[model samples]
Target: MIETEAWVLYERSGGSESALDSDDFRRETFAFPGPAGDELLVEPLFGSWEGNMTHSLQRRPIDICKQRGERRVVIGNGSVLRVLRAGADVRGIHEGDVGILHGGHVQDEFGYTVLVQGYDAPGTVGVLAKRTKIAARNFLPLPLESHHRLEQWAAFSVRYLTAWSNYHLALGAYRLQVNEPLDPAPFVLGWGGGSTLAALDLARRAGCRAAMVSGSPQRLAELARMGIVGIDRRAFAGLEFDEGRYASDPEYHAAYRAAERAFLAAVHDWTGGRGAAIVFDYIGAPVFRASVKALGRQGVLATAGWLLGMQTTVNRAIECIGRHVHVHSHYIRRADSPKAMRYAEREGWMPQVSEIYSWEEIGGLARAAAAGRLRSYFPVYRVNPV
Candidate 1:
């Protein structure tokens, strides 16, 4: 067994709210049984964090390892790594090959993930460790002698793959209804997030008039410089409509209505009443309604995020039949996942990372992320020198 130095939390958090306050991370030694016949031993160059990992940090019983009665699990999902050694059965990829890992467990027929990975996958260690083993199929290699920086590849390793896959769906749906004869260049709008930014980048590159709504002026300005129209999210305040408050509190409903009116009016003024041909709203629940309603006739609304709040209430009758709005909801398709990293690399479309943390600062990264202190849409961290 090759001993690996990794950061681990012996105890899981009791609830979702205190993911940072409990179970402090400690760097310690653990046994790593090298690689299986179909697996490769990889050393990660960098890794990124995502919000979906609350299940592992919270120590939910539903976690894959917890269900199997395992207490210690390595935590990291998105990574850019180098293959140090491969099983004898592995082919095409050998020692010194560099690739990105998109994590998941039990891939379905379409190839996308049904269950999340990282701590969620059984017998798997994440990129946070000194070294880890992964199935050869999960590894996607960058093109030969790629000139992009390690940080750029690290940031793009995870998010851009999903973004490229999903935004392609949105554009295809939009083109189905609004074609070149009707509108050669349809307008696209996406709410703020790393995926949203990546999708918006594609939209702009595809010759669509693209815009992004974000609360951060820095983020908005950055995208704007890249030719994407930036809309301020703060203009429509108190618009996070909770299902519970919206049902009982008449005042909350009225306020939401007022914000909705202002938001739609802004959309009208901006688009000249054309409404967006494609509206991507990955930030589900709080802003789902506005995103759906902002769509024009025969427009496409794309969503997959559920970070802020999960339980959503939508006007099923009005949006579909009355407005002709189509909701394209899913992650990436199986066929779409394989070549996304190389595509993003070729296009030079990488997600922005405002900060990069060090190996010893994993705890600080968790606390800052949980507290909403991260200044960028995506932040990456170092795991190894290579």
Candidate 2:
């Protein structure tokens, strides 16, 4: 057994720790058994804490539905690494192979589970303790040209896949099967957060006019540079933009919903009275109602995350039955990594990484995420331990 240190999270006595101090994360050397079968020991190069990773580490209900036996490492997606050792049966990847690790865990109704690589440590190197049957699907090979941009590739891997799958496969496929051929006249509306940027890119590629809903001035400027329109979520909802008030005050929410008529009217005007063809929203309750209202006839709303809040008050009669709108829920899958990587290479697009840090800086990064202060579209960490 080889001993390597990794960061692990432990459940508290009663409720989970809400605030992130230095004590929440720990680095301990663990004994790892050598690969015996189809497994390949991979040393993660760079990783990022995106939606699931951030939520699992700092969001409320930190221990929601978690049992005593759950995995200690609270990581999710985005790992670009080199393979160290490979078992004889492993076919798709070999020693010294450079690839991105995908997914957190996959499970079926019968309890068959596959824990894809997680960003729990995000900085330290460790052996994959689980089985390796899923590696064939999860490991996506990166081209030699992308080696120098490991941080960029690591940051883009999961976000690109999530956005690509939601837009290209989920929303795009639905449109082709149901109504139109997804023509150039269609408008694509993307909500806030990391996935929105990628979805906007895909929408533009698909010959649609892509627009984003964001409140940050820097983000708006960035979007303009990319030739995408930016709609301030606060201005769109007719609410004075204040992140703190929006979170704590119920009146702002009610007012925001009341201003939906204005928002929908603007959407109609933007689309020449046709409304949007597709709306991408992973934020769940906060913007879901507006997403539903922003759609045109037979439009699709694609979703993956519910970070703001899960439960939303939706009037099914008007939103669904009346408009014939479709709600498609998709989770990131291992196969998406390769598809997105190929698309990125072909399109000459790379991830927008803002910063890179060593593994020890992960705690500070986590604290920033918890405080709602992380501004980088993607922040990645290198796994080099002293």
Top candidate (lDDT): 1
Provide the overall lDDT of each model, using Cα atoms, as 2-decimal numbers. 0.75, 0.64
Q: What is candidate 2's lDDT per residue for 1-386, written digit by digit as tens?
A: 65566665544445455676565556655544566566667677787767666665663634522532444543445767677777787787877787776653454453222333443323222222211222434567888775337777777776777776677655554566454544544788887577778888877776778888787899899889888888765656553233455679889856765677667776777788877778887777766777877877777777766667676666777765545445554445554456667778878566677788677777777778777778888878777431
Candidate 1 residue lDDT tens string, 292-363: 888888888886665566566677777667445555444455456656766666777777666789998987
Off by over 4 Å in 2: 59-65, 68-71, 104-116, 119-137, 177-183, 236-254, 257-262, 320-323
User: TM-score of every model?
Assistant: 0.92, 0.83
Error of 1 at 69 (Å): 4.2
**Candidate 2 to native Cα RMSD, angstroms:** 4.7
